[model samples]
Structure formats: structure tokens, C-alpha cells
Target: MTVTVVVGNPKPASRTSTAATLVAKGLRPEAEPTVIDLVDFGAGLLGWGDPAVAAAARTVAESELVVFASPTFKATYTGLLKLFLEQFDGGTGLAGVLAVPVMLGAGPAHALAPDLLLKPVLVELGATTALPGLYLSDRTFADDGVIEGYSDRWRPVVRALTDAAKVADHA
Candidate 1:
């Protein structure tokens, strides 16, 4: 299956990106994920019809699984993520795609940001969120087993959802 990672961190190769990649790998080890760091899109994100940005959106839309990640800002997801998400159509833009929202923060205060804020947007874009959103501590994510544990519990659920979506398509 095709898995895609979309990082909304402003920094090109930020820790958020790394965590997102790791999450994608943990979810489906065999899949070589397509990592799209929005920073690479540069100023194109501000305008419309940019080939690279459109390609990235298409890649995510076509993927079987996708990790939409960003660092928590003011207790919410970054505006950068919002900009990228706005590229997709309001409904059915991500049809048949399974999305996992991930957010990293300095403290635990905004741990619910992913579920409360990001997940809704993904749902509105027509993606199925089969499991709880993941929240990681920006300071300790690398050494923590959060991703592993989450994968253990939800990977199967993700697989099931994917299978169900496929079946629905054929029916």
C-alpha cells in the first residue's frame, strides 16, 4: 500500500518531519512512504496552480494511508498545515484515504490538538480516521515508545479500515 507523510513544520527538516516519517514507518513498515515537507513548496503554498504543490496534494489523495503532522502552535496546528489542507476540495478530496493526525508540543497541555483540531479537517476532506490521533512530546519523541505502542494498537485497525474501504468501492 502507498503511505504518505505530510509535515507542516516551517523548518525544512524539523523534528516534526522526522517524527512523522517514523510514524508512517511504524504503521506500515514495508511501505516506502512519500514524505512531503511543506517547506519545500516554498512561496507556492500562498498561490494557486503550483505544479509541485498540486502534485503533493494528489499524492496524498491517492495514497492508501496518510499521516498529517504538524507542531502545535498556540495550542493549535500551524497555519502552514491549514494552508496545505486548504488546497484539497472541501468534501471527498481525500476519498478512500485513511488519515492519522499527529501533533507535537512542548508540553502535554495541547495533547488533544490533533484530535480536536486536525482530525476534523481531515474528515471534512473525506478521509477516514480509524484510530485516535497521536500526540507526541516534541522534546522526547525520539526516545519514546509512543509511536510503537500506537502502532501496535492501531495498525491493525488501519488495515481493517483500508480493507473495508476497498470492499465498499467494489460493491
Candidate 2:
């Protein structure tokens, strides 16, 4: 399966990116995900039609599963992520892709940010979010079993959905 991890952290190679990569690996250990760290795009996200940004959007759109992750900024996702998301063709850009929203926060105060805030945007962009969004503590995401636990519970479901989506796409 084509799995991708899109990190919206303002800092390139931040902890958020590492957590996101771990989440992707937990979901599909065999798949090597294409990691898109939005900070690398820099000014390219300000306007439309940049080749690299467009290519990144296309890569996400074509993936079977994508983990859209960001650090909780001001109790919501970072604007960098929003800028990248804006490249899509609203409602159809992400059609047929399965998305998993992930957010990292310093504490549990904004634990619901992933589902309450990010998931809706992914849905609006036409990605299917069958599983609940994942919220990880930026402080302890690596040592914590949260990603592994989530993967253990939802991996089979993800596999089923991706298989079905592939069939539907072919049909």
C-alpha cells in the first residue's frame, strides 16, 4: 500500500515529524512512507501552483493511507499545515484516500484537537476517516505505547478499508 506521512510542524525534523513517522510505521510496518515535512516547502505554500507543493498534494491524494500530523499550536493545527491543505481542490482533492489525523500537544488539555479540529478538515477535503483521530503527547510519544496500541486496534480495519478502496477505484 502507498502510505504517506504529512507533517505540518513549522520546524523541519521536529518531534512532531518523528511522532508522525512512528505512527505510520506502527500502522504498516512493511510500507515505507513518503514523508512530507511542510516546513521544507517554505514560501512555496504562500501561493498556488508551485511545482513541489503541487507534487506533494498529488502524492497525498494518490496514497492509499495518509497520516496528517501537526503540533498543537494555539490549541489547533499550525497554519503551515493549513497552507499545504489549501492546495487541494476542496471536496475532491482527497477523494478515495483514507486519512488519519494526528496531533501532538505538551499536555492533555488539547487532546481533542485531532478529532475536533483536524479530522473535519480532512473530511471536508474528501478523505475517509474511519478511525478516530490520534492525540499524542509531544513529550513522550516515542516511549509511550499509544501509537502501538492504536495500530494494534486499527490495523486490520485500515487494511480492510484500503483494500476496499483499491477495489472501488478499479471498479
| lDDT leader | 2
Model 2 agreement with the true structure over 43-120: per-residue lDDT tens digits: 999998899999999999999999999999999999999999999878998998999999999999999999999999
Which regions of candidate 2 deviate over 4 angstroms? none
If candidate 1 were superposed on the true structure by all CA atoms, what would the RMSD be? 1.0
TM-scores for all predictions: 0.96, 0.98
* Segments of candidate 1 deviating more than 4 angstroms: none
lDDT of 2: 0.94
Task: Give Cα-based local distance difference scores for all models.
Answer: 0.92, 0.94
Q: Could you say which candidate leads in TM-score? A: 2
* Model 2, position 4: C-alpha lDDT score: 98
Colliding residue pairs in candidate 2: none
lDDT of 1 by residue, 1-171 (tens): 889999999998999999999999998888989999999888999989999999999999999999999999988899899999999998899988999999999999998899999999999999988779999999899888999999888888887887787888889
